[model samples]
Target: MSAGPEIRTIFWDVGGVLLTNGWDIDQRGRVLTALGVDLAAYEAVHDEVNFFWERGLISARDFFERTVLETNPQLALTFEQLWKLVCDESKMLHPECFEMIAHLRRAGSYRLATLNNESKELNRHRIDSFHLRRFFDYFICSGYIHEMKPLPEIYRAAIDISGFAAETAIFIDDKAENCDAARSFGMIPIHFQSPAQLRVSLAQLGIAI
Candidate 1:
């Protein structure tokens, strides 16, 4: 197997696979703790609004207003402040992963893209802030498509948008559910553990990087 017809494309997950999560549970906990916000109260509202929020149906301000702020009225954090905290969590970039992305690009071996579940603003922040466009060809984000992972719709959309047969593509993500979903869709799934492990797995498919 080579990086020719065998593996024509690579679909990466932005949050865990390529970068830190935009606003996952760990990131939310850190940001909320720093602001002295109640976790239980915040999660209650977060669960209510997150589905629509990530689907790009609501603006950043509205998402904040509906989530944490709605539950904790005394919290004086502004939308910008809260959004910044969420974006900052994604700043912990993985150098090895980045290097591999660059290597794949330089090899000109396959199509590279990102498939992630995040809000529009935070997704844009991570994309531009991390210069993801430098390597990835497409950004199949939940914000734009209104489809999240572990769902057949999102996997189908991603496969269609890539213009490659799912069997010829590889989907890399940290979540077992997401990976399982990809496998069910006929796309190869790499349950990303670390950069080193990822490299080994890809190497098995003749994708050196």
Candidate 2:
């Protein structure tokens, strides 16, 4: 039997794979507590608005007005203040993962891109603050593209943009569902655990850094 096509393009997920999640449930709880806000009220509206926000269907102002400020009127914080809390929590980026990316880039052996589900304001902040553009040749984010992962269309769009066969592209994400989606779309999927595990997985696939 023939071996699979050589992996030429690598797609990375931002939240868990690249850095800490922008505003995961734990982070939200922490931020809310720090601000002395009511958690129940925020959670009541979070489920309704978070996905839409991540998909860029709503602006940051609208998200705050509808989900946070309106839902809990007693909270005495501006949108920017709350946003800063989220940003603070997201700074736990893994340096080893970035080092690996740099090594791969220096080798000039693969095309690198980020495919992530992120809200518009948060995504913009993270990318700009970290200078992630320097590392990636392209970005496939839900905020700009209006599509989140575990969906076949987003995978199709990324594959289309890279101009590579899906079979020759590898996608790395922390979520199993997202990895499964990539596999279903004929892309090699790596379920990321840690930076060390990732190095091992890539080495196994003949993608040694």
Off by over 4 Å in 1: 1-5
lDDT of 2 by residue, 1-209 (tens): 12789888999998888788988888888987877778887887797898789889998878877877766668767788776767888774688999999998888899999999888888888888888888899989887778788877788899999999999998999999999999999999999999999999898889876
Q: All candidates' TM-scores? A: 0.93, 0.94
For model 2, state the Cα shift of residue 173 in Å. Answer: 0.7
lDDT of 1 by residue, 151-205 (tens): 8888999999989899999999989999999999999999999999999999888
In the predicted model 1, the residue pairs found to clash are: none
Give each model's whole-structure lDDT. Answer: 0.86, 0.86
Query: In candidate 2, which residue ranges exceed 4 Å CA deviation?
Result: none
The lDDT, on a scale of 0 to 1, for candidate 2 is 0.86
Q: Number of the top candidate by TM-score?
A: 2
Cα RMSD (Å) per model? 1.8, 1.7
Clashing pairs in 2: none
